[model samples]
Target chain A: MTSALSAEGLHTYYGKSHILHGVSLEVAEGRITALLGRNGAGKTTTLRSLMGLTQAREGKITIFGEDTTRWPTFRIAAHGVGYVPEGRRIFANLSVEENLKVPLERGGPWTIERIYKLFPRLAERKQNRGRQLSGGEQEMLSIARALLLNPRLLILDEPSQGLAPLIVREVFRIVQQMKAEGISVLLVEQNARMSLEIADDAYVLDDGAVVYSGTARELAADDARVRALAGASAEEWTLT
Target chain B: MMTQLLLFNVTNGLIIGAFYVLMALGLSLILNLSNVINFAHGGFLVIGGYIAYTITPYIGFWGALLLAPPLTAIIGLAVERVLIRPLYGRDPLYSLLLTFGLAFMIEDGTRFIWGPQGKPVTIPAFLAQPLSNDLFFITGYRLFMVVVVMIAVALLFLLLRYTRLGVRIRAGTLDLETVAALGINVGMLRSLNFAVGIFLAGLSGVLAAGQLGLEPTMGTGLLMPSFIAIIVGGIGSLPGTLIGGLLIGVASGVTAVFFPAASEAVIYVMMAVILLTRPRGLFGEEGMMS
Candidate 1:
């Protein structure tokens, strides 16, 4: 089967400082691929480069077998790639309904009605401005917004970041559900154990290079390696 | 007799304020979305007024009024595509300098084309008459200007509130990167936004020509007041801009009643007081202004 997203020898830079150095990876169809890394490991950079937000200086990015290295961020999105950035970047002045209506693509399964059904909390606060919602609700709104694009591949940057443990589980469960519906996911997360639990495949990144790649179960078995590579607290996975 | 004088001045103030609102709303829209001050806004206004002057001899005032703004908007679109689009994502100083240069070029270009003279715009004969003796200052044309401004303002708000493109423009103003991520062509959005702003400036010119007459420097004279309106209203809030323009207009009107010499100075004073007390102007969002 063709990979949902793929990149080869990705070289990204911020000013003169190089971030991603010859990094390559693949996210297979209908699977969850967790990109694990410590702080400044270039996980977000990887996503940004793929989305054409940062404009990778040198790389080859292919989305669903089409070369997308030179595409703009909007074109990348139109090609069925939905990105929920690290900060959630919700339009604070806009209402939940307005936020959902922002994405232009409407010809998909993930309508606003389906999203409201998926996250009932969103429906309850539909009229409330984005700033009025709690952090968990904001995260859900961001997720629902991306879904409205009906993207084939959803790239989430640290969905569990800054959320309460309970909320993190709730978000993760939704991610798992997305996988079940046959949407490929490229999840960048700090919660290594929790991500690996549901992730079909895992790649550990360090210093902008992919250090390890294997089945999630294989990575979970090597405790010391996961700890040294991911630096995710074991307590993160203890809730479930 | 005193009450009548006050009423006259207040009505005069409202007409002036309506003009400011028309100009400032466009400035505010472009500022909100594009992050450029558009010094050439005044130039576009002058262009609009001049277009009306040239066409009025043939199409008449009403037709010129309808046609001039779109023509100006078309030129604005071309200006944006050629000159402004390249400066996006760069230091705002570049766009500022570029637009500042454009302002001079447009002013000089208009002067060269139309000649450096105040051109009288002929209004409809019915509008030239005072509405009634009790309110002699309320000429049919003045009332018409206010009504047109109200309708335009109402339609502007409705477009932003109800239309898909308007929703995207507002969304783009708040978070452009995310809007683009949602598959919006932000480049096209900026062009349309710049053109809409110029259209307002153009409309202001058309109406102002009927009241104040057309000259090369007419737009420059009104530019500062419109900027004050945007500042007073709040940088990011459209409703704030509307209120700000009216407030200053009324203040100037009231001041003219008591101290005729200080009419223009009063708006600057109001702006300073708002900046000192609120800093965000009347409607400005927090963290919008530096």
Candidate 2:
């Protein structure tokens, strides 16, 4: 299958100390690719580097067969990539509707009306400021905002972080729904079990380098390796 | 007789308050989106007055009034691109110092170009007249300035509320990184925002020139009050600046009638009281700029 995005030999740094050391990964077209790592394993940094939010000292990032290594964040976004950063960085001062309107309206199947229909909770709180929304609702709004960009590849950084188990399940369902709609997804999550269940392909990152790269089913089946590589969160597989 | 005097002072205060609002709103806009305290804002005002003064001989007051602000905005756009653009994402102190230095350069530059002597912007003869003998202080030009400020303010609000650029600006002010991730050219947005702020400054200059007359040092005197207006209203809030400007104007104006020496000091006192009580200005959001 053709890849939606591929990053090779990514060497990223924050000031002097190195964060990502030759980290490389790929997202298959119309499939969810899970990148699982423990705390401080550089999952978010990898996402940031691919999106050009932080430049990689040495790497090549190609999206849909085009080089995007040197592109700026907005240019990368404009080229049909939607990113929902960690912490659900909602514009607290803006209303729900205004937050949705912040993304440049790329022509696509997703529109504000469709977003409201998909997330009725957001429609109910249309006039409410983003800060007023609960964590679950903020995640929904962040996802809805990215969807409005009508991206070919949607990169979500820790959508399930700081969320209730029920909300986490709901977010996973939405990821599955996006894949069903033919959009490729690159999911970075600490909850390995939930991510592995929904993901088709998987890469386990340990200490800023890929420790294991294989099919999601293969990684999920091996409990010993999943625990060894993804750390303690792999045990969360039994809870959900 | 006493009530009539009070009424007159209140009216006078409101007119001055309107001028403060125009100037302060521009400063607030630039501060909100760009986080740049454009000390050169008053310098732009001086430029506007001088441009109007220089061109009035050929274009007339009405034409200069129509042309000056946008022309000043174009110059502001260039300054933003060339000088201010590099300092963005750096320490806020750098931009502040740069603009502070720029203010001095502008003052000296204008003095060199226009001479240090005051120059008057000739108003139409009809505008200089009062409506009646009893209200001799209410000249038609002052009334016209109020109307023009109101219209400009209304348009600014409409632009921020209805347009796509407006939505992006308000959103960027809250969270710029997210806005950039969503494919908005935040740099372009900021440049446009800076221009809008400078446009307001230029308009203030043109209006002030007609009333107070023009000198290279004129902008410096007006700059302090505009800064106070922002602090009194709250940073990052446009409506608050408007109210702050008017409140200070009225407070000072009424004080001028009762105690002439205390007129200017009253605004500072009001600011102190608001800070002690609310701590966020009248309309500032909690935890903002904390």
Candidate 3:
């Protein structure tokens, strides 16, 4: 499979506090790649680096077969990378429709109508400002907005961060829907079990370095390794 | 006589208030979007008035009115690109100080170009004439200024509401990072936003040249009231700035009748009361646009 995005030896830092240490991974075209780690495991940082929101002091990031490590956030985004940053970051002052209108640059297969069809709840609150939406609705709006970009690679950072498990399941369903539509996804999640279940390839990150990179199913069956890396209960790795 | 005095002062206050609204709205736009207090906003106003004056002799008042604002906006965009763009990620203090220095330079430059004496901009013969005998305080031009301001403000609000660029601006004002992530060029947004703000400043200068006459310090005189208007109206709310400008205009106008010396001082008193009672101004949204 062709790689949609690949980062080689990415060394990222936040003002001298080194966050990502030579971390390298590949997200294949049309497949979900999960980066799972503990809270301080640099999951969000890696996603941020790829988005060029923060620069990697040392490394190369190539997206859709082009070098994007030196590009700015807007340029990277313009190059068909859609990022849903952590915390939703919705423009609270803008109405739902207006938030949808915020991105001047548009892509295919994701018109406003198409997005509304995907999340009917967002359609109902079209006139409502972003702040009016509940957590689940906000997540849907974020995903819907990214879909409008019709991105080559969708980078989602903690889509299930602060939600009830039911809503999380719904968010994952949306993720599955994206995969069905044939778009590649680079997902950073703390919800290891759920991410691992949907992801084709997985990387277990510990202290800013990739401790394990292999097929998600293989990692799922290795209960001892899952516990060792993620500190999750070993039972989570067992196949239901 | 008292009723007549009341009518005159109230009308006078509103006209002054209109002037403040024009200036504050422009300044507010730049401050909210760029997080930079353009200390040179008044200087831009002076430049606008002077530019109109320079060209009025060549193209006449009608032509100057049409031409001056776009010219000012272009100058503003150029200034923003050359000077302000570098300081965006730095401390706001840098932009503030740079604009502050630019204010002095602009003042000196205008003085050097136009001379220190006040210069009168020629209004059309009909506009220079009073509307009627009953309300001589209301000039054709004063009413004209109010009407022009109303149209501009209305158009500005409409632009923010309807257009694609305007939607991006409103979104940028709230959360620029997300707008950028969505692939909108935020630097270009700031430049356009700055130009729009300066356009208003320029428009006000053209209007003011007719009423107060053009002088280097005229912009400086109006700048304080605009700042006060923004504070009293609520820092981030454009409508609040509108209301605040009008309120203070009428307040000062009314006060002139009772205590002639306290007219300018009354606006500060009103500002103090609002701050004490409601620190956010009338329409200010708490925890919004921080």
Tell me the DockQ of each model, to 2 decimals. Answer: 0.57, 0.59, 0.61
Chain A only TM-scores, each candidate in turn: 0.97, 0.96, 0.94
Between which residue pairs do clashes occur in model 2? Answer: none
Q: Candidate 3 residues B29-76, lDDT tens each? A: 998888999889999999999999999999999898888988999999
Give each model's whole-structure lDDT: 0.90, 0.91, 0.88
B1-290 in candidate 2: lDDT tens per residue? 77778878998899889988999999988989888998999999999999999999999999999899999999999999999999999888999999999999999999999998999889999999997898878899989999999999999988887687888988888888888899998899999999999999999999999999999988888888888898998887888899999999999999999998999999989999999998888888732221
Query: Can you tell me which runs of candidate 2 are displaced by over 4 Å?
Result: A228-231, A234-240, B286-290
CA deviation > 4 Å runs, candidate 1: A229-235, B286-290
**Alpha carbon lDDT of residue A18, candidate 3?**
96
What ranking emerges by lDDT with the best candidate at the front?
Answer: 2, 1, 3
Per-model TM values vs. the true structure: 0.96, 0.95, 0.96
> Interface RMSD of the predictions, in order shown?
3.3, 2.9, 2.8
Candidate 3: list runs displaced more than 4 Å: A228-240, B286-290
Looking at model 1, the pairs that clash are B234-B284
